[model samples]
Every structure is written in C-alpha cells, then in structure tokens.
Target: MTDNPAPAVVEPIPKWHEFMVPVLRVLSDGKPRTRRDSLTATLDEAGMTEEQRAVMLSSGQPKAENRIGWAMSDLTRAIAVAKPERGSFVITDLGKDLLQKNPYAITQEILRNIPAYRDYEPQRQNVSKADPVDIAVEDSELDPTEQIERGIQLLRADLATDLLKRLQERHPDFFEEAVVKLLLTMGYGGAENRGRRIGGSGDGGVDGVIDQDALGLDQIYIQAKRYAPDITVGREAFQSFVGALAGRGATRGVFITTSRFSAGAIEYAKSIPTRIILINGKQLTELMIRHGVGVQIAKTYTVAEIDEDFFE
Candidate 1:
C-alpha cells in the first residue's frame, strides 16, 4: 500500500466578536442564561464537542478564556451587554441592534459604536501601528536598542500579568508546578518531581528538594503551594521554611506558591541570611512560558531593526 501523508490541520482563528455573537443571539432570543449556560449552549450550537470546548476554553493560547473575559468586560461596559445577575448575562438593546446590523462584525466596529469602549481601541491599535514620521521622530529622541529592549520588557510584564490571572482561574496546580520548574530551569536546582509521595513522613512545608549542582554537593529546599484567589503567603510560613532550610544547612531556598506574598513576608525574606527567592503565581506562570518549561511557542515574529550603516 502507498504511504498516505497526514493532512495538515489548520487551527481556527478566534475572533472576539464571533465568540460574543452567540451570547448576543441567545440573549436577543429573550432567553436569559447564566455564563455557564451561555458558554455550554453556544459551544454546542457551534458544533464543538465537550473536549473541543475544553481545549478552546483553556488551551493557554492567545484569545483563550482570559482574553475572552477581557473582551466580555469591555463589551459589558459598552452597553452592548448586561449582567442581570452574578454569572448570568444578556444582550442589551444596543447589542441586539448591532448584532443584526453588522453582517461582518469586527472588534473595531463594536468599539467605535460604544462610548465606553472607544478609549481602549485607540490604545490597542497604537501598540502595533507603524508610522514613518512617528518612528523617525521616536528614533531621533531615543536610542533604538534601548527602545526595543524597553518594548520587550513591557510586553513581558503584560504577558506575566495576563498569564497569572488565567492560572489563578484555571489549573492552579499547574501554577505551583510552574514555580518549581522555573527554579529548575533557572539552574537553582536539578530536576523537579512534584507531588512525589515521600514515605510515611510529610515534608513539612517542603514539597520538593534539589541539589544546587549535578554532583549533589549542596541541596536547596522548596515549598510548593496551590493557592486560590486572594490567598497570601504569610510571614509565619516563610519563617518555618527558613528554619527548615537552616536545619539542612542550605543557604538557599525557594518559596513557590500560586499566591501573593504578604508585605511582612517580603520584608522578612529580605532581612534573612537564608537566600529566599519568592515566586508569586503571576511571576511563576510568566517565567514558565518564557523559559519554555510547560508551554510551546506556536508562533514566532522576527522584528527587524533598521540598519543605520545603509544610509552611509
């Protein structure tokens, strides 16, 4: 038999308006639905299976639920939609009107029509806009290398924050795993084995431990936690971890958690001789994505810099 080549699967491009369209339709139909109901029903009508919908909702891809939530927030503010009760949403008259009128709906059209949304549209547009005059003036005012570096930094910061928000909402355990992986990736320790059952004894606050080097000359302690919303790592926990590190004679320790550190914890960590690195849920997810620990880059953009020598 002749070998058959595998067919290329083209991923569907997610559109903000497309996702919102079904919700609007449901609401316009005079059927009030909860967010869960709306999401499930819309996905069903769109011919998406449960597994497909699950992947689409939490695939860690761009315009996933986190981005969708951002779009939903904007749409809600613009009077395009209304949340009659917590977790329940319906289309406003404006949304229904726009839905019927715009056959080819774009985010720009939605923003332009909504007074509350117009402010955000221009800011988003300016982020990727290229104007020769503006570029020339900006180049003259700032060093090109510095400008690019700063841009990358700002993008990284934003990505970190967005990843954090999403992690908190879904796969919180992954966030904790992410911290351990990030530390391992950064060469603070060797390989990471999370949630390993270590015989009858619990590891206290410590979840995993690794050597500072391959030879296993020194060991670093780790405390991994999967935390929920508004959870904060307190000073007492930090002190206990420090004590554990001291007992082991490890100068370095990592506190990895899917939660924010208390102000007192931050101050206490700084004052201690035990070198403690704190990775909050946000930073943990960001570092994991950046370092390619648990994420794969689906797209790559090669941003070119202008060659000044060409003018010479």
Candidate 2:
C-alpha cells in the first residue's frame, strides 16, 4: 500500500488588501457599527480557521485584526466607507457600488482609481516623471508597512552581496583580522575585547584566538579561510583544525570561511568531542551587519502614532 502524502500547510492569514472586500461586505447593510463590531464581523465573513485567527503580530495585536484595520483605513481613504459618528462606521453609496462591481476581489489598484483617494494620498516631492507606470505598480501591490519591510529586506540583501565581494578581493590577512574583529564585536572577547589575529608562517591551523576573561584561562580558537565563493571547505581541512585545537588543549573552536563547507565537513564537526561552530559567507556578512562591524547606519526613519491615553 502507498503511503499518503502530507497535507500542504495553508497560509495562516491573508494580505491586508485581501481583507478589503470582506470589510466592505460586512458593512454593506448600511447600519452603523462600532469599529470593533465591524472588524469582528469582517473576520467572521473572512471564514478564517481558528488556527489562522490565533496568529498574532509582534505588537501584540491579532494578525487578522491588524490587516482588517489597514483594509478599513484604505476603504476610508477611498471614501467607500464613512464615519457617521465617533468610533462607528457605515458603508457609503460608493462602497455599495464597489461591492456590486468587484464581486470577487477589490484591490489597491481599484481603490487608486477613485479621485477622492488620489486627493487624500500624501503627495511626494520630486517624483520621477519618467516611467510613471512603475510608481503605480509599486504602490498597487503592497500596503505601506509591507512595502517598507520589503524595501529594507532587498536593500540588506544587496548590501550583503557587496560586502562578500569586497571581502573576497582583499588580502587573506585582512579577512583573518575581520573575523577576529567580528568575534570581539559579538562580545565573545569579554568587555576588554581581548582578541587577536595570529595567521602567519609559524602559526598553527588556527588563525585567531579570543580570551573570554581577563586571566585568559577560558579561550576560544578560530580558523578563518579566505576562499572564493564557489570553493567549499572539506573534511580534511576541518580534521587538520581539530588536530591543531587538540594540540592547544582547547575544547571549543570556530571555523569561518568566505565559502561554504562540504556536507562531510559539517557532519564531522558535529560528531567530534570538541564544540565547533561554522560560519559561512552568508552568515558572516549577516553577523557583520547585525553587530555593526563593517557596516554603519546610513539612515534612520521614525514612525509615530497618535497617543490614545493623552486624549483620555
């Protein structure tokens, strides 16, 4: 008998824009409802599973409620929903017409076509006159917060690629020194930052060492290899490093490389008595960014919201 395949995992929640039509439909009866009541009704109309509804955002709000809130914000900007009284909302005639026209899905592009929405949208200064369609396409897909997060992720990815390329171009000694600095920045060298690169002709397989305390009783050895991105560090190299660690009577070591490790190398490291930590090119660059070793902050953005308690 053939074994049954595992069921595919369903997405826990829909995108903010996906909640637009449901929000409108919930208020289509033209009866005024509190924001909380409208959002609860919208969630019911969305037909989300209990597991899906249990998802929460980092801000402690339910994921479904946050997306529904954004959907309502967009619908309000488009003048499709009206606030007839404080904290209560009712669908406008425009919303009814939209529900009739877009029976299946209502998207940001559809909302953008409304003149009222365009008027309400914040105007940008010095927007490129060339390729206007690109701007529209960028705005139509994701809501504001999602767009910001996506943009930041793409920027970091590009920055990581450039950092790896530059590191590969420098001298092998530079790369060795960089790994030592990274370890110090990560707080591995204690508060005094006792770490040094010792890669030379007389040096053993280890390239760097970090003292975890002032007395240097507790120490961690490091082996850094500056290889091309396509090169893979193999088991033989790790065996040599492990032998060197044994010679130094050390139980912990870190092996960092600009390339990747062979599967055998990884397995061998895990099987050994000594603790071995491996850092590849991707991980190295990410650590550099996170600990602000080689990269510096270029810009900072601050987002603020109305203080509800202040009004009270």
Question: How far does residue 237 in candidate 2 sit from its true spot (Å)?
Answer: 1.0
Tens digits of lDDT, candidate 1, 1-312? 998998655456355455566556656776667866776566554455444444544446433344345445545645577666557777877887777876344354444555433322322223543322232244466676757664554345434444544555555445545555666677665454322212124665566666666666777667776675347899998899898777777898778776679999999999988898898766676667778775566546577878999987
Worst 10 residues of 1 by lDDT: 192-201
Candidate 2 residue lDDT tens string, 117-138: 5433433334443322333466
lDDT of 1: 0.60
Candidate 2, RMSD to the unseen true structure: 22.6
TM-score, each model? 0.48, 0.55
